[model samples]
Target: MTLTVAAVAIGLMVGSVTPLAFAHLAENTPEERLGRTMGNAELGREVGDAGGPLAVGAIAAATSLPVALTALAAAGLASGVLGRVALRDDGRVRPANPPG
Candidate 1:
């Protein structure tokens, strides 16, 4: 029961994060390369979506489930930091237009 709840929570988190990342990519990308960038991004996302659980399972098998989850959390934090740095505003993304 606890594990089920945790799984649901994690699923929610991943669901939100992935779309937000894609939206950020879309908003920041050049119009000419948007399709290609989105395609590549989706491909990478699919790979990660499939591979992430497998990697966590492998880590759990090698060590323990708690340790594997801890490692995943650490990786998430590190990636968040990297993403913030990479996406830092240098005025590259177009400014949002005022809605009429």
Candidate 2:
């Protein structure tokens, strides 16, 4: 029950945030390259989706499940921090081509 609940919560969070991420990317990317930017972002997401579990499983095989989970969680937190820093602004993503 707990696992199911956690999974649902995670799904909801990801589902909600994904659109926002793409919207932000669209806002920052140039009009000419928006499609390519979106494609690359989706590809990166697919790679992470596949690689994250594989990475955790490899780590667990070498160490332990708890250690692997901890490492994964730590990596997630670090990446979140890095992204926040990289995208820091006045609560808005400025357009790549602002209107005159």
Candidate 3:
């Protein structure tokens, strides 16, 4: 019961912050290659969220829930950081803009 309530509150907080966060983040998103950038973001999110189930089902099989949850949270944080770097306009992840 307590966990459910806490999860609900966290969900609500994320929902509320999402739009505000996106408002600033969208501007930082490279408009030129936006399609690819958004695609990476989408893929990152899908993999991160889905990975927990797969990872837990395998490695977390013997681990306690708290430990598993913490590991999942760390994975999520790392993904978020990676997404920011991956979406940047730098040639590292994003290729240089095509010549006109």
Candidate 4:
């Protein structure tokens, strides 16, 4: 029951964030390459989805489940921080150009 609840919570969080992430990507990406950029982003997401479980399983096999889960959580936190830092805007005003 706890695992199910956690899974549902995580799913909700991912569902909420995904559209925002894609919207940000679309906003920052060039119009000509938007499709390709989205495609690549989707591919990367799929790869990560597949790899994350394998990573956790490997770590669990080597150490313990608790340690593995902690490591995964830490890694996720670090990734979020890195992405936030990388995507932060340097204070500069620019005109908005809407895509046709």
Query: What TM-score do all the candidates reach, one by one?
Result: 0.77, 0.73, 0.52, 0.76
Q: For every candidate structure, what is the RMSD over all alpha carbons to the true structure, in angstroms?
A: 5.3, 3.8, 5.8, 3.6
Residue-level lDDT tens digits of model 4 in 1-100:
7556655655665576667778999998877889999999899889878998899899989998667666766776687778789888889865565455
Candidate 1 — which residues are off by over 4 angstroms? 1-9, 90-100
lDDT of 1 by residue, 1-100 (tens): 7556656766776778888999998987767778998999899889878988998899999998777776776766687789889878787645454233
The candidate with the higher lDDT, 3 or 4, is 4
lDDT of 1: 0.79
Worst 10 residues of 1 by lDDT: 91-100
Per-model lDDT? 0.79, 0.77, 0.59, 0.77
Q: Candidate 1 has which clashing residue pairs, if any?
A: none
Index of the highest-lDDT prediction: 1
Model 2 — TM-score against the truth? 0.73
**Candidate 3 accuracy as lDDT:** 0.59
lDDT of 2: 0.77
Residue pair clashes in candidate 4: none
